[model samples]
Target chain A: MIMLLNECKIEMIRIFRNPYFVFWSLLMPIIFYFIFTKVVDTGVDDQELWNKHFLMSIAVFSVMGSAIMTLGIRVVQERSEGWTTWIKVTPLPSSSYFIAKMVGQSAVHVFSIIVIFIAGIILNGVSMTFVEWVSSAAWILIASFPFLALGVLVGTMKRVDTASGISNIIYLALAITGGLWMPMEILPKTIQLIGSWLPAYHYGNGAWGIIRGQFPEFKSIAILTVYLLLFMVLSIYIRRKQEAV
Target chain B: METIVEINNLTKEFKGKRAVEDVSFSIKPGEVVAILGPNGAGKSTAILMMLGLLHPTSGTVSLFNQKPQEQKVRERIGVMLQQVSIMDALKVKELLALFRSYYPTPLSMEEMIRLTGMQGSELNRRTDKLSGGQKRRVSFALAMAGNPDLVFFDEPTVGMDSTARKQFWEKVRQHANAGKTVLFSTHYLQEADDVATRILLFNEGKLVADGSPASIKQRLLKKAVSFKMDGHFPKEQFLAMEHISDVSEEKGRIVIQTEDTDRVLSSLFSIEMPISDIAIDKGRLEDAFEQLTVEQGVS
Candidate 1:
């Protein structure tokens, strides 16, 4: 357990030191939330409803980017650069490698969630009850797992250069199609149909439900669980197929 | 005496083609054994199997009488593979600390540096920010962090400068002095000859020769019987010998290539032919090793 913590400690340092996280994980989501809510479309009749709704959208956006881009691309880089092979020869158990990445990246996502939630409160004066705030934050944190599993799928790419591109596409597609960028009502029917199938849609909707005095739907939780299992099994299958030993 | 490594019939096949054939050897404690072979000689494949990175199609690799992947076995061994195996953004000290924490009984920072012959000043810099030579030194330091009982280095001197190369072998020698079993693979003939107590000469995917450096060098000396013949030479006589590999004529001299040059010379005296200006040319050791990899690679 001490060794695993040490691994997580180094992982945190590595993630924090990387300039990429600043752009994609932190600054981009917060800036995009402000632009979409305050600058781009501010003429909504129910401004408070819009503020609360967009807050969930951007919160889900932030965690999803961290899970797929930050966690996923780091895995690809580490594996391609020989860190994975190096660890195999060490006394550290193989399970610890994955667990450390999962735990460490989740911690960073927690920070992202808190920061974006703060942005919603201070910037838009969006108010929520304490219970609603805590429950929604908890929902977003737990809902981010499927996307983290998707990140591992990206890590299995044959080349790091291509992994970055593929992961970027996956993150953006889920964000836009899953109604995290805008509500599914504004999107065409075809996109809405596709968005509903994505875990991102249900994850964002689960957070939006808490503020409206509606707990998350059973179907949303079920869909998210299904995607989580799918991503994990797919990533494991691809990884096993690629590796010779 | 107990052996540190016991490999038996270790074979690895990539698809249908073999990368490592049925090769076997054992290493005792305090012996510096070199896996000497040319490129694609399966040295890295064998080492990978021994370290549990590769699976043999049919064989076993035992380190300290346990499976290579066992955690108990892993705790006692250190490996330095032939690649840029370092994490980026972490300072050298952080990387060292992180790797050291993986082992239960790790060497101190100062002791790791001392054993690696490093100056211990590069610890403050990030690993990716270091120069090539500095990165190699830090890697060497990481390999020694566990204060391992058995150290495995796969082509440890592949892309090193003269000073770095000399320092690496010097560090290996230092470890050998402390009774740590060292096993390294190298294509450089002189490296094996200078550093190894025992040499395992591999050709293709098979181990062709195994013995002390002196004895293997003697066998790999590559001798030939050459004579200046004024009349028609009896090439058929030398060609018929099972020991003679080649009989080629060059610049008015008939050269009879054989593993046993004395036999060629004795046969020449036994034949009723005028053989004058006879000389034995002991070719360079590299040529003999090259011959081993090509002519005797199979079986």
Candidate 2:
């Protein structure tokens, strides 16, 4: 247990020290929040509802961006550099290694969430009860789990150079198609259909639901859970294939 | 002496091509062994199998009488692979601390720094900022951090300068003196000749020669006599001489492979061959290595 915690601490230190991770996970989300909420008006009649909706969307986008892109790209780079192979020969358990990665990514996710939330409250004049804020934060954080698994899958299967492009494409695609950038009502019918099936759509909906004082649809929660399991299994399978090779 | 490692009839095939075949050897406690081989000679493959990073197609490897993958066995062995690159974002001290946490009992931080000759700000620098040789030293320090009973280093000194290489060997010697078993693989003949108590020569995925460096050299029993022969006396004549095993020409010089250098010389004198710049050398590990690998390649 102590060793696992030590590994987690080491990974946390690495993430914080990296400038790229800091820029993408903490700073970029706040920048995006300001641009969308303060600069680009949604043209909705209910300004309060529009503010809350955009807040949830950026929060989900921030958590997914950190969990999938930053964490996944780091894993791919580490594998290419042979650090993963070095760790495999050590007495550290494989479970501990992964848990450390997740914990480290989770720290970045939390930071990204706080930055986006602060941007919503201060710059956009968004208001919410303390419980609503807490619940929305909890749901957004939980929604990042599937992206974490997707990050591992990409990290295990792709090279460092290609992994970056692939992860970025996936991150942006999920955010845009899942209606985080615009409401599903405004998007084309085909895009809405595809977005409805995506894990990000469900994750965003879950957070937005909490802010609107209603429980998220059980179907969305279930589908996100299923996607998380599938990505987790795929990541493990690809990782095993890599080790065997 | 107790046996620290044992491998029996080990073979590894990749995509139906043999990388390591029918190889076996054992190491005794306190013995420093070197796996000497050229590229594609299966040195890394065998080491990987022995470390349980790769599964052997056939045979078994036992470290401390336990399977290599077992937690108990892994805890007692430290490994530095040839292709290892440490995490670039981590400071040297942080990396060492993380590696040390993996072992049940590790060397103290001060001892590791001292052994690897790391000092002052070197330990505080991020790994990505380090020079190639400095990174190699950090990897070496991580390998020894576990205070392992048996350590495996694959071409550990490849990027090190001469001075750093010497210091590294001194540290290995110190480890052996403390009754630990050290096994390293290298293509440098002099590295094996100078450091290893026993040498394992590998060729084409097979254990071609295994013994002390002197013993392997002695078994070949062939000295090289070379001279500039001004005119071509028939090469067939030299081949027919007594005590001469083979003859080859290099850079317009005739080199005779002879077991008895004196007899070959007297025969040459009798023939009145115009010979200048005469030099005779005793058999070296390089000659034995060449002869062994070449012989294996032939048949």
Misplaced by over 4 Å in model 2 are B219-221, B224-299
lDDT of 1: 0.85
- lDDT per residue (tens digit) for residues A118-194 in model 1: 98888999999999989999999999999999988888876888988988888899999989888888899999999
Please give the clash total of every predicted structure, in order: 0, 0
Q: Tell me the tens digit of each residue's lDDT in model 1 across B1-299.
A: 66899999999999888999999999999999999888888999999999998889999999999999999988999888888668998988788788789887899978776654445465677788888777777888788888899999988876787777888889889888999999999877667888999999987899989999877876676678788887776678768867788899999999877777787777778775687999988764555366333222111
Query: TM-score for every candidate vs. truth?
Result: 0.88, 0.87
User: Residues B1-299, candidate 2, lDDT per residue (tens digit)?
Assistant: 66889999999999999999999889988899999887788999999999988999999999999898888987899889999698878888888887888898999988888865678888898989988787887888898888999999998877677777888899889988999999999877667878999989887899989999776545545688899878665789888878887899988878888878898888889988888999897765354356333221111
Off by over 4 Å in 1: B115-121, B228-288, B291-299
Measured with C-alpha atoms, the lDDT of residue B188 in candidate 1 is 74
| Worst 10 contiguous positions by lDDT, candidate 1 chain B | B290-299
TM-score of chain A of 1: 0.96
